[model samples]
Target: MNEIAVGAHAPDFTLTTDSGDVLSLAACRGRKLVLYFYPKAGTSGCTVEAHDFNRLKADFDAAETRVVGISPDPDKALAKFRLKQGLTFDLAGDETHAMLEAYGVWGEKSMYGHKYMGVERTTVLIDRDGKIARIWPKVKVAGHADEVLAAAQAL
Candidate 1:
């Protein structure tokens, strides 16, 4: 079960990004952070979600917010996906799933009759103080960025 909740202090983590740079939860402090978790990158749904976030990046920036996408993909795969999609924001790799578990996005998932462990599609909106302001669980890709942008703008 996802333990993270609104009004709670978001779990801290350090991850490797597609650009071979390090990103830490602490680094996002003092800024509105939109931390999004996806099952995988380059897949249809994930790609759409990434593109949607990338598309609204300017708006997010205007709202003084930063977006970070995290998945269990390795750094090399994340690099390829980031390059392929022309994503400007940080795409982090969680190969160990430690950060994903700390954020409660990693768990067992079932698809069609088969069960497997994977990342759940979720988004946590963090306030400038690093507390969770909102959360979107089991996200629907279509128009998701608009919804997130509205919330971020409100914050």
Candidate 2:
């Protein structure tokens, strides 16, 4: 697992968004960015996380930050989730899991005695200078967006 540390320069990446566009670390330069990684799309937990981020859209915007979600799902699934949830931010599919691995969110996971590889529900806050400002590993969905917003605002 490629673990990233806060204060380290964020590894740059470009991912294809649900809208057929793209979200790149370089594009978000000079502004804060929140990149949340989830195991799957359209699941209950993932939906709640997306909604939390969506609900705080205005607050995030006011904080001069951009929020983007990353997952291993295909673009089709991501598009559906974004539309169904009416999410204002971008959702990018990392089917290749390259970016996910670079951020160290993809790793061994198990449920009901079955071990497999998947995303670890991580969120990374990248500051304007492209350094990692904060990282939430094994994130709990409740109040997560609010917490991230507060951090972004502080930056």
Candidate 3:
């Protein structure tokens, strides 16, 4: 898969959010977006990452950016995770992995020397023009939301 580069037009997608509303990238065309992909829902790292983004959601809104998280988890799991974590942002289901492939964040991963295919922790900052502004691949959860918020504010 070719990695999406900065300044490239973000691929458009429509996925079901935890709220049961369909969210389309085209609908966010004129707004800055913080589209993040995580490996799973309700896990430690994923939980922290979602909470971090949720905690700073107001700041993101102030910066004119909308944050959305995507995972390969089913919509039910996404809904439960969002409710349990008190996340205010959208948690979208990508069970088909189409969005994952389009964003090039799903690939080989290793844990304890065992290889597996999964969604990499990635955050892509899309400018209001709908172009990729920044990409954070293999993201570290701690302080990552702040970093992405800073980038969004810069945009």
Candidate 4:
């Protein structure tokens, strides 16, 4: 996978949202974006991360930044997860892992001494011009939304 870097143009993608509607990165031009990738829909870490972003959705909006979460889960699972968690922001379904791989977040991972291919928890901050402003790879959930919000506000 090609690693993305700051100042590089972000890879554009179109994916299905939890709402069953299509969302494209190209549509976000002229607006900053917080594109976060998670491994699974209903897992604990993923849930906490999603909720943190949800809690800060208004702040992101105020900063003129749109926050979207993506995972390999299907639209049905994504929708159910959103409904269960009451998340108002977009949660995209990347069932093909195409977006994940494009962002270099899909690769080898290890848990309990076992290795497998999976999506890495990552957050990419795209500037209004669609260039990568910052990337949080292997993100930790605690206080993470605040950090991303700070970056977005700075942009």
Best by lDDT: 2
Off by over 4 Å in 4: none
The clash count for each model shown is 0, 0, 0, 0
Error of model 1, residue 80, in angstroms: 0.6
What lDDT does each candidate get? 0.93, 0.94, 0.93, 0.93
Backbone clash tally for model 3? 0
| RMSD of each predicted structure | 0.9, 0.6, 0.8, 0.7
- Can you write out model 4's per-residue Cα lDDT over 38-149, one digit (the tens) per residue? 9999999999999999999999999999999999999999999999999999999887888899999999999999999998899999999999999999999999999999
> Lowest summed-lDDT stretch of 10 residues in model 1?
1-10
Per-residue lDDT tens digits of candidate 3, residues 1-155?
44799999999899989999989988997889999999999999999999899999999999999999999999999999888888899999899999999999988889999999999899999999889999998899999999999999998
Global Cα lDDT for candidate 2 = 0.94
Cα lDDT tens digits, model 1, 20-41, are 8889979888889999999998
- Checking candidate 1 for backbone clashes, the offending pairs are none
Q: Give the candidate number with the greatest TM-score.
A: 2
lDDT of 4: 0.93
What tens-digit string does per-residue lDDT give for candidate 2 at 115-154? 9999999999999999999999999999998999999999
